[model samples]
Target chain A: NAGVTQTPKFRILKIGQSMTLQCTQDMNHNYMYWYRQDPGMGLKLIYYSVGAGITDKGEVPNGYNVSRSTTEDFPLRLELAAPSQTSVYFCASSYGVGGKAFFGQGTRLTVV
Target chain B: AQTVTQSQPEMSVQEAETVTLSCTYDTSESDYYLFWYKQPPSRQMILVIRQEAYKQQNATENRFSVNFQKAAKSFSLKISDSQLGDAAMYFCAPAFFNAGGTSYGKLTFGQGTILTVHP
Candidate 1:
């Protein structure tokens, strides 16, 4: 299986611009998550989905939204990109809660 | 809310030497899970090891092992025969299971510890 896959490995956005970070998994996992990591910092949960059609905000959900239409895809949307949004984003999938999660390579976003 | 903390901001170990990274967490739940994830320069998060709070037996993966002290809420990673490839940022995370049977599966991560391995 390809496991977790994320598109647009790197992106640069100007202030107020918007874009979506796509994430897909072939493992057919029901749990998916979106996390952001600042330089030399730990990962911060942004949004998560327990299953298709169920989405919830995590620790740092402001300025971001997510949708889980299919078990395979859970994309993160940036409504109005700000400089503070610049960070490395990672998409991960797992079979269930507390299960070992498989992570994507990560998408580096730079908002100027 | 549960929180994970890695006291050390950075650590270094010589080739074939041993290194330990300290991680402590605070939670009210009686049962939970803890994990250590390693992120190299490539930006891919790899699971280094995991431990269940209820398990008294420490978890070990080849050269990597964990000292799980449930009473102290400490979960430290011990790396033996440290290799150059072990240089990376290590994250300590703690997760709790939701009561609804839907795994919240959200990990609360610490600030992170950057491990450097010198040859």
Candidate 2:
């Protein structure tokens, strides 16, 4: 089952370059989230969308943006990448607040 | 804002032994939920167990169980009969809801604890 699919499993970007991390879930869930995991660190919330056209900034939303235009899609945007932005990104969807979440494999990104 | 803390960066246990991972959280809201997520080498976030603050009984799933102390604000996970597959990074998270019950699943996560199971 294609529960959650993420594009570009691995990516390398030069400083100041921009890129988009695509995330889509086939479960038709209403809540979607973006999180980043630094080396040896726990995942931190970047952005979350409760429903289509509704989005909110998470704990570490700086340098990142997200849009939930439909139930199946929630893409994260990095306008000007920096070395600090290098980390593993995960997209997740849940049926309700704090409920079990289905996550994508992850996107490993490195900024040079 | 809520906060969660997992002081231990690493832990280990024998294949057949038991291990408990500690987690503490602080929140003002009375209604909330707690979760333990496991991330193995595949980078897949799997749900280990969940506990609601209002529920007095601890949450248990197969060999996974949680020790939830409401007053102490502690939520620790205990894995019985540990196996090699249980070796992974575990995260403790807490989600709070307001009077209207709209939290968006916003979570405060603790620094993960890496579990090592020695065969």
Candidate 3:
């Protein structure tokens, strides 16, 4: 039941140097998301959480910063990294709002 | 503010033939949900079918099917035997249940449809 578990997976930051793209989920989901896939562009909503310490700001949240403190983590922070902050970062979970959304096997950031 | 339109950026079928991938949406929010995601190049975002705006009954998952035409809001995806692992890159997501703020489980996606299964 490793539903959604994203980690380094791949990275290459340099522009401003800063990284943190790790998501976790064991299905206790309370709806957590952070997406950004930009090469044919299809997934872009970069911050969300609806439980433990709630956080929000999606639709490509600026430079990105998120934290859900508990309930199977949801971390996506790229403090200063630019170059349009690279791309391909996804982490999702759902068990509410009409559940069914679980993805994560991506985190291919490359900000050179 | 809801928008999801996948006017087929790409599509190809042959292997067993039967491929229909097209989605359209625009909602002012009336309790919604519709999805079809499959990004395979190992990008892994697979959740091939789901739809329920008020449930007019149109959602399947064996040979994969969905043709919900909620008053022409249209949600289409039908892949019947065409499997070369069913190619990849096909997404049309829209999950809007914003009763006010904290918009519940927000998801809005489009600009995807690249399925090519030709053996």
Residue A92 lDDT in model 2? 88
| Model 1 per-residue lDDT at A101 | 88
Off by over 4 Å in 1: B98-103
Can you give the lDDT of residue B55 in candidate 3?
A: 88
Across B1-119, the per-residue lDDT of candidate 1 in tens digits comes to: 88888999999999999999999988776577889999888989999998887789999999999999999999999999999999999998888765664437578899999999988
lDDT (C-alpha, whole model) for all candidates: 0.91, 0.92, 0.87
Candidate 2 chain B has its poorest 10 consecutive residues by lDDT at: B99-108
* Deviation from native of the Cα of residue A92 in model 1, angstroms: 0.4
Model 2 lDDT per residue over A93-112, tens place: 98877677888999999999
How do the residues A1-80 of candidate 3 rate in per-residue lDDT, one tens digit apiece?
Answer: 78898998999999988888889999898889888888987998878888889887887799778888899998888988
Estimated TM-score for each candidate? 0.97, 0.97, 0.36
Computed on C-alpha atoms, the DockQ of candidate 2 is 0.77
Which docking class does model 1 fall in? high
DockQ of each: 0.83, 0.77, 0.33
Q: Show the colliding residue pairs in model 2.
A: none
